[model samples]
Target: MMPLPGPSHQPPPLHSTAKRGRPPAPISPDAGPSHCAWLEPVRNALFTSGLTLDDLVVRSGYSKTRISQLLRGNDYYPSWEITFSVTRALGLPTRPLRRLWAAAAREADKADDWIKNCIDRVVHDGEEPPLPYQAFTDDVRGVYTDYARAFLLTDQRARWVVSQAFDILWVCWNTATASENLHRYAWRLLRSCVIARASRHQDGRPDLRAAVFSTRGIRDPDVPGHLVFFTELIDLLDAITRLPEDQMDVAVLQHLCGAPHHVIARILGLAPALTRAVDHHARAALEAILTTPTPE
Candidate 1:
């Protein structure tokens, strides 16, 4: 991963990119009605299995309404029992779905922690304090650094991308009211910045596979026996840039930036269901792109 850029090379001032008009309504930690990420996969699996909600109800011994609620994320975090029951009904492998469920659960826990910290600060310290900007910068920088390295393929360029993202965040912070969930909001800003930068630079160009192959161990280390791995990574990045803009945004935000569906929906001004649909299509597109034979 690339190192975070220092303060010297500041990104340009935010212009039309910041969407700086009528601040979005303050978001609650559990504000949205969107389901968890695993819900769509489960739904797809159920469809493939020729099963309906009624069939799920019968299989899980849960009412239609209850099953709907669990799948819709209407009850905030779904219970482990509910997830396990749904997994059984879907008749798919357990581990991947379990991992998604675990991630959702962890996000819920983080929300709860943010709420608790706010309460502690207000009641104990007598002021609702915002997290230090540096701390927030440090936390998000690591994730964006990995994402930048994966996409840009050079440490200097990756650091520039991350630096630009933070510059956007700083602009948003000064202009908009502090959201209740600071980290989530900051992430949204960074995501937008990265997407805009990637799109602007891509310019509908073909893959630079030749250039990438020629560089080899110069920019990124070869590690003696990892040539194939490095080649695949470059291919993946090239494929991601080729994805449709909306699909690419969804893929980057969900997988690269680690934003949940609802947050992604909010950032993109999209409905949660639509967001999930785009994500599903994006994954399929990426799979096809990755699996296609590269020209000799």
Candidate 2:
């Protein structure tokens, strides 16, 4: 397998693509809903906190226009600095808010360093993230990242989604560890984070059409013959998306990533036999789909 790109991986600029003097374009249609979803909690917090706009301007140290735009989900996704400022002013926990902000930033296609640097500025009361959580991240971060990138189709997005998942895991570390299986709980969390951001077909199942088209790796291949394989790969990926959720997960982690069945079972917290069964069913389904004749 290819090496995962480091945090420095830079894709085309997201909201910052406009000429220097011109304001960046409005958030795309696809990103608007996600941006608003992340803001919902912040809006609720502001309402219940009984703080007025003027009060937030004073407490957050941002101009009223800036706070209003941030609250309204306008122009661009807000930076963590402003988000943390407003959330702190409202006396909310920073951990969960950071997770939401990270997700929104990824939707906006914000750079990895931009997210990290924004998060780094938040004062954690001199408290480090829990040591056990740190250890847990070290354990599954690799497979988790590859699993995500397989769906998201880019190193940058996969990294952001995984980063957000870890942020969420850190926030709920106690509950996660106390659950019946830590691996299962973390896996479910990670799965949800990726699926929530995945592009979708008209049927609302996860789709890779956008990722497959936009990815530069396929467009600029290192080998000539790889282009012929890419056509077949697209069909295979589409078929995988058509599987039931459990079967899809098993297929991707097992067949796509080359993870051993035992490792898959451990990560999914399924019995080894059941994991194999799901993979078996997934393969059978894919074969049926691929072998069926197309209409003339």
Candidate 3:
């Protein structure tokens, strides 16, 4: 078959060919909705950075076509290496992007080994955590894991969240150390990791229904009493989730995780007085919620 003429009449270009580079193709329809969560932000970053395909090519060390493909979410999923390069060039924060990329990878059914390999290829500084960073991780790792486990209600998931938090913190060690509160910085990283994976309700608050199942061990002896206690616990937990952000965090870390007040203050980067006040308010609110009777 012979090729047809391109067009009856060519349309005007959006910009002068001299000044405009090839815009990225529309994001591939094959990409899942979950993938778009991270992909859209990446495209937005590129647009706001005012970087052209050629600029991305130069900074990301990938070809123009590859860079364009990555931005468009075309063909196969891009490895963490190229994605990280583009994001780094755009000066986006690595921590949240790392979580989003990992979620996209899982949605794409990328194997755990493949994900790790892709992440490992993106070296930071000397590709090793500094001595001080390592020491800090060692000191707080256990407590961080405990807090994650209590909030998430699963040891395996808690470990994964903690691992991801530590890896991102490792990448941003210099910035974390330079911050006014390293403990608080690391704590925020861990919290973000956990919450990113946490299931949510229709209203967008965390759906912590799994917490009820964690109390099953206490049901062995008194079935009736345990059921009543479980019902009350559910209402209490629901109330806790509705608390203001700082109060909610304080309640979860101090009451749910059984961490000391001073430790909670350090982890939250709050003054001890502020932390105590938040705890007091949280308790008062929970008490008011549970004690108030329902009207017919």
Candidate 4:
């Protein structure tokens, strides 16, 4: 039998183009709501706000599979895509994120509406909310500047990047968590690095690691094994050590390290076309660095 001609008056059924599948699963007890304690509330809040995982996937500009995984309660590191999408979708003001940042998940539930509560907190944060720790700035600065500098490197750019990185570390390590004592530490670290590198002509190369860490004061605590860059950064730094000096490319270094591209671009002031070239050379250098022999 022949199908009838397409509808003469009405549009064809949407099913003609729609995927064949059951409707998405609704929230179910069996789904056991993903535990990730920090993310659970955010997920619930999104669900109750006339949104769904599919909506999140579309709005967040993430792949459908990725959003599904996130809804399953896995840990999510906030990024530009998720941050911008959620904020825009919910129509959040500039400051709502701050309240969300500081409020405990349960407290978010206590409020009648998370959105209203966030707005109220934003309006009042200037008046009565406790300010973030002064040290928060230093701590954050320490982490971010290193990332910034690592991506802006050239021989000329090197010292400036080092300087910026040193600025944060110097303040964070040598001074009280409050006072920015970076001046002395910055100078000392840079000078020490220069001296160690310069003196390598004699002692077959100084122990740069020892030199870098030793200046942190007598009580200089060991850097946490997973800190700063976590595992990826540590591995990348190791890769840098083995790469040939001339082969290094800051752009490539960031990619292999999983550093954000926009951030690296902002740091280097280079156009977008350079990304692949930078990534390729940087990866090659990293591989070489991993295999380089240290002069004993």
Count clashes in each candidate, considering only residues at least 3 apart in sequence or on different chains: 0, 0, 0, 4
In model 3, the runs with Cα more than 4 Å from the true position are 1-56, 68-76, 80-106, 111-126, 216-219, 293-296
lDDT per residue as tens, model 1, 44-86: 4454455567767766667887777675566556655566666
Best by lDDT: 3
Write out the backbone clash pairs for model 2: none
Per-residue CA lDDT of model 2 for 215-244, tens digit only, reads 345767885667766777788889899898
lDDT (Cα, tens digit) per residue for candidate 4, span 240-263: 544443223352335333446554
Q: What TM-score does candidate 4 reach?
A: 0.24
Better of 1 and 2 by lDDT: 2
The whole-model lDDT of each prediction reads: 0.55, 0.72, 0.73, 0.38
lDDT of 3: 0.73
Model 1 worst lDDT window (10 residues): 120-129
Error of 1 at 276 (Å): 6.1
Ranking 1 against 2 by TM-score, winner: 2
TM-score of 1: 0.35
TM-score top scorer? 3
Instruction: Give lDDT tens digits, candidate 3, residues 242-275.
Output: 8887888888777677789998897788899989
Candidate rank order under TM-score = 3, 2, 1, 4
User: How many Å off is the CA of 295 in candidate 4?
Assistant: 7.9
